[model samples]
Target chain A: MRLKTRPSHREKQLSEDKNFLHRFGYAQELLRDMGGFSNFAISFSIISILTGAVSLYGHGLTYGGTGMMGFGWPLVALFCMMVAASMAELASAIPTAGALYHWASLLGNKRWGWYTAWINLIGQIGIVAGIDYSVAFFADGLLSPVLGYRMTETTTLIIFALVLVSHGVLNHVGIRIVARLNDFSAWYHLGVVLILVVSLAGFGKGELQPVDSLFRLGETFSDKPYWLAFLIGLLQAQWTFTGYDASAHTIEETIHPRVRAPWGIFSSVAFSFVAGMIMLAFVTLSIQDVHAAVSADNPFIFVISQALGSTFGQVVLWMIVLAMWFCGLSSVTSFSRMMYAFARDRGMPRSDWFARINKHYRTPVAAIWLAVILSFILALTDYFIKLVNPDTTYTTLAFLTGVSVVGLYVSYGIPIWLRLIAESKGRFTPRHLGPWNLGKWGRTVAILALLWIAIISVVMVIPPNQNAGIALIMMMIVLLIMDLTYYRHHFPGPEAALQVSPEELARREAEFHD
Target chain B: MTMLGVLLILAACAVALAIGIIANRNVRAFNEETHESFLGDRKERDAFEDPSVS
Candidate 1:
């Protein structure tokens, strides 16, 4: 055998580049290239409908609305959602896995980027766990009767396992396939919900109640404050519309990302708002007794079953359950990609493992599975807790998810402010969005959205009861404990990823040209 | 019997899994070929970077 030669300096550089490309898969030139406006609209619409529909029926319209009575339930839905829409637009334009956190780092002083990404990452995983566990709840409801089994913790685990595996396999299939499937899921969800809601409304036997009486914000049966209910409703709306930033996570994979990604993000939010409003209206109209029905287990299912008998109703319920699984799976897929992107940058523990792509699937299989396993474990916590107290087992995992949503918005707001600050100092210039510039409107909208999200975050953590207060506190503790273990070691990084100095990059380009 | 239903479910899952395994293997082969063809020192650039190759 011949002796190996030492690598030349250029060879060493080439080798490092090759290794990086191999690790991350081929450079998806998505940052500079993305599909047309239509593709953005379609993809965003798909993801939004998938994420939105499950929450609308399961929680948003009825229970969530009931909680936000003080803010004029319907009007609150309208105003808060408009802010969310503007925020989504901002997130879309700067789509990256670091997402809002990365944007914050890029726009702000370099010192803040690492901590911001950490917060966003923590929030994202919490949302993944929440969405996945909800699938368990919905699946358990559908399968219990079909399998001739009761709603035990074991059955819930099985439900979570099947979904986790299906999602893992599907995510392994790659982004193009996932986007196509999401397209089907979006239209399928709309079709199913439209058919079910219309059919139930037309054939339903329940006498219609007056909207004015039903929405009377101050009408209270107990000592609970009316404002408390409204605050809860706002939280629900936020949850229902929360994950539309999914488009931002896929920006690296999209073609012509800056423009298209923003469109996707905004369209998903706008479409979901419309579709969700309709679904909420239909469910509100379909209820037999609004007050009593909202409190029932699977209230939407109850409304369907009451209107269409057990046989036909169960079919519709099962369809919704399946759609919910698709939603959860899609959400998890986005969540894993975000984690993979961050970990690839050595921003997370097990960066090598987390960042690894499946050569076969052209997907982040390792990250996808990691997300699933974590979610599965979280789902088990519900079963264990509920075993001790039957009533408590069905606690709001989504509320914890709401905390993450607030975290996401804060991540978003931080970046927007930093970008503005950088612009003021002449260190950053606003990127062109072609002729569709928000112009002066961008500044006004951005400020309003940031303030609104901050307020919502505080409202979300307010305990529903003394017990809920304690629960919220403990949840924060758990999140903090987890963060310390994984992220605290590398509390920050060497500070290059955060450097978005326009002048420096410009100078480098000039030198290279010379 | 519903046991029949269970068996049918298992059979469907088997069929799906088989297809997935075959598909996964084929994709792996394709990626390996692509990596060799595009990034391989022997191969010249074909036009430019693929739009989908992020």
Candidate 2:
């Protein structure tokens, strides 16, 4: 009794290549405007690890997994970096503003392409909001603690406005300045953080705790279980890695970016992971009490103060303040670029206006300003929330951002999975990846990274508390409404629909092939 | 150390060595092929659009 073969739905979809042709207007010249590999790395690192300072909000996550888990924060950093490296290779191959969505379209059916773009759009916008809100949170952190002044809604508004305007002006000046600034930020950020970590480790007068003590640290917090700690740390790690693809988003503006942009994404992520791990290890070894330190107080600052006294601590504090500013400002650069790209594709509202470039500066000044305003608005809302409920403020925003990051990982994974499937069928092979090649291991690592991202995404959106749950639902509703009403109506469907006909494709193929 | 940590440290070292080796290979290849440390070629640039075949 031979069983009849069942027709597979996905196979049917794959056979429909008529719907798979893509729009390819982005010229190689776009890459020339982008600074270089180092600038790309700096942009990515600045946006990703800087805001991860909020991990103090969820330190319980790292508390119980292993004696090694005490220092697992750094390992988490390493994992995030590995994920970035995998993503970088793919981005280098397909240097498009649409990024992951376009990648999905290239490797899979057309129907999935629109949905992929939607998911990525959601993630990118959420990141912008998250970064802007982080700016407010960190700014509030400095003013509130040191000045002993309560941060008002107005203050947050003022901070947001100033930052937005500054971001707008910087983007207006074009790529060279942005790249230079990013380079400066990379060194400044690392140098300052290094000083802070070393000072805390070597000079802190507080009773030093062994790294082993952090293993059961959550026991002292609220008697949480081991799984809870592991869960929290997973979320924290995801947060730290939220923007490791800043280079991918701005490939349109980089020089020789086809080769260098991927390096930027992979290398920056690699640097962040290694550097972050070392920093976390030192901090964990030097921490007084995980619970007390990560409290409403400036945890790292608290540690530094205990170790180095007010004078030296003050200097470190100033450095941290500058770092946060640079981090926030650099994020503006990335977010604005993402916004401009989305707008350019007519995947967003007011594409004509938002996608417009300043002729002299050759930057998307309009999109930059739009992002700045929206970010400012989000920051103002965050400030109001904080004023209403100080205890839940930071955690709430962090959790929201975490949920949004899920959208990013999903965006990254779908394209990769499509590529993996294609490769299995001998439809894809990367011959020019050179020594950066991971071979079969690339697929394995990518799949692992995808699984990790999927698990954490689910964990993040689950809501840690009843209040958080309610807020999450409301935020989703608001975001959906905004997208449907404003963006959906305005978006020119499937930017890839602007296809060069078979004739043009043939001409270009023949002309370029030899 | 945990498996992850030990593995990561080893991986990092391996990656560093691989990069060094690749850099050396690139330099040598360029020198042998074209008598220069810089190896970028117009043909290579032409191949940029479709790297799958290179």
Q: What fraction of the reference interface contacts is present in each model, in order?
A: 0.00, 0.01
Candidate 1 per-residue lDDT over residues A175-215, each given as its tens digit: 66666767667777778769776776676666544443334
Using DockQ as the measure, the top candidate is: 2
Worst 10 residues of 2 chain A by lDDT: A14-23
In model 2, where do residues sit more than 4 Å from their true spots?
Answer: A1-23, A27-31, A54-71, A109-111, A145-148, A152-157, A214-223, A294-296, A380-394, A431-436, A465-514, B1-54
lDDT of 2 by residue, A120-140 (tens): 655655566665555665577
Error of 1 at A444 (Å): 1.2
TM-score of chain A of 2: 0.80
Give the TM-score (0 to 1) of chain B in model 1: 0.51
Interface RMSD for candidates 1 onward, in order: 20.4, 12.7
- The candidate maximizing lDDT is 2
Highest TM-score: give the candidate number.
2
